[model samples]
Target chain A: MLVLTEGLVELNVEAKDAEDAIRKAGQLLVNEGLAEARYIDAMVKGFQDIGPYIVVAPNIAFPHARPEAGVIEKGVSIIRLSEPVKFGHPTNDPITLVCALCGVDSKSHIEMLQALATLLRDEDKLKTIMNPEASKQDVLAII
Target chain B: MKIVTVCGMGFGTSLMLLLEIQSIAKGHGFEVNGEAVDLGSAKGMSCDLMVASSEISSELVDEPVEVISINNLLDRNEIEQKVMPAIQKLSKKG
Candidate 1:
């Protein structure tokens, strides 16, 4: 359970679609050395080919690729957008939080998935995380 | 027991729903095996039941699927009230 601080949040972030947002977020991870730079494009392309399913909860998005898709280590990156981003799902308003993940293996990925499930289930906590005024400590504290 | 959870995306909500299903099924004394795949992939996988959001359920047709459309992924009561009955019905059929 690695917590991303400082480098993850992109204020007033803009993207054309869900895939663009993920690509931008992945690039941030690469810049921080949290993941390989090559993974950014592959991760974005993978989701595009598959569909925009990563826009999970109404305001939350988790963009990821399979374990074999150039992940050197297991990691998680959090990005809080100052404004919401759309993924074309009418029920989903707009994404306020983006959790970009890379798992080393399926077992670890499952554990990570479970933890994420629990976190997103909490509406109050999700609101706290999505707040741009909230610090890294506040985001980590909620999780 | 085999279970499949569906959401708009295979990566997020469906995965989360599967976790809750696994936890509930485990408590109910069932040995469960679950996975989260996109609604499109549901046609290819064989499972005892399929749990999905109400929006996704409308698109599915002509499968032996026992579809449970959850209103909210975080609501355990909704899962119990809506999803559990569908699973039970499927279990009895098998």
Candidate 2:
């Protein structure tokens, strides 16, 4: 299972755009040696190539790259932006939460995503995570 | 039944979709084998249904299976609303 420790969560971050938001989220993973710097670029490129489907829900964007890009470990970095930014999606745009995922392989990949999918589906839990005053412990407790 | 979830890289968004698809399938009392595949590999793969974002599903129009395009992947209600009907249609055809 992918344990989302307090180190992986950042609250009320500031970003210039969607790319900046993703980069900041991925940086948390890189800082913990979970992924390399190139993984961040790969995630940004994924958005450019694949579009804003990564914005999986209203005010939330899940950015990730292929494992081959540069995943040193399996983990996730959660960033709650101070302000929302547009990701160009038809419905789910202006993302406030950016969840950057780094998977070492397929099995663990699905495992991690399953956990997150469940967390994202809960409206109340999502409300807490998106709250600006939410501490890292508060966020980790729910995830 | 088999379902394939398609996305650009396969491991990220598509895998998320596959998990929800499997859960929804189970809730509806359907046993399904789910796989997540990249856009490149999904074309040659065979399955009863294909689930993906609207952008990726548009590219899969030529595939043999029923393609269900969803607006939001994490929203189970949207996925169930869109995918269940297609699954029912597929079962009837089979």
Candidate 3:
């Protein structure tokens, strides 16, 4: 079943940097009772400890920690930026979309990741969602 | 054949890529043994192929493993296009 809801969708969000974007996206998972505050902290730290390699696609990023980080439940949340923020990806930069994924184990994360990846393939859908005019139905169409 | 998916940390995107590689490999009429590894560990692990994003993939150019670097890690079409021909070559050899 899909964990993303109208509640988990945030359109035209403001974030100062990649760390802010990661925290904001992770917080949405926490708000929905799927993750903890510590998970959010770990996410920002994960990027800092590792690098900006999480920017999986052009203008898109999936900010997440391991299943053991603080996943209360399996879930996905999204934040569409009002203004693009750089995640320091070498090529795919100025990210406008951030998705946070939390899963209890590797098994569950695969299905969710597949779904997210499918959505990302549609550049038109992503562009539509990035618009300030997008509605709950619009974002839900893909998520 | 064995394939490894790599990321900064193994538990997240790399594992996701491993699952996709497994599924895609099946479609190509071959069974692949898959593992997920961090970029640091992937350098030492022996694998038929290493799939990762452009940034991580570029860093491992000097490694002996064949690299399938994708501009968009989530795009299966891109993944298949870049990876299958190489895997086909390996399959023929095996």
For DockQ, the strongest prediction is 3
Q: Give the higher-TM-score candidate: 2 or 3.
A: 3
Local accuracy of candidate 2 as per-residue lDDT tens digits, A3-89? 887779989899999999999999999999999999999999988887776777778888988788999999988999898988887
Give the runs in model 2 whose Cα sits over 4 Å from its true position. Answer: B44-46, B62-65
Q: How well is candidate 3 docked (DockQ)?
A: 0.67
**Could you give me the TM-score of model 2 versus the true structure?**
0.89
RMSD to the true structure for each prediction, in A, is: 3.2, 2.1, 1.9
- Candidate 3 lDDT, tens digit per residue, A1-143? 56678779898889999999999999898888899899999889989988887788888998878887899989899899999999888888999999888878877876777778777777787777777798768888866
Go through the candidates in order and give each one's C-alpha lDDT.
0.70, 0.85, 0.85
The order of the candidates by DockQ, greatest first, is: 3, 2, 1
- Model 2 DockQ class: medium
Q: Candidate 2 lDDT, tens digit per residue, B21-57?
A: 7778788887778888888899979888888887677
User: DockQ of candidates 1 onward, in order?
Assistant: 0.37, 0.58, 0.67
Pairs of residues clashing in candidate 2:
none
Fnat for the candidates in order: 0.20, 0.53, 0.67
**Which has the higher TM-score value, candidate number 1 or candidate number 3?**
3
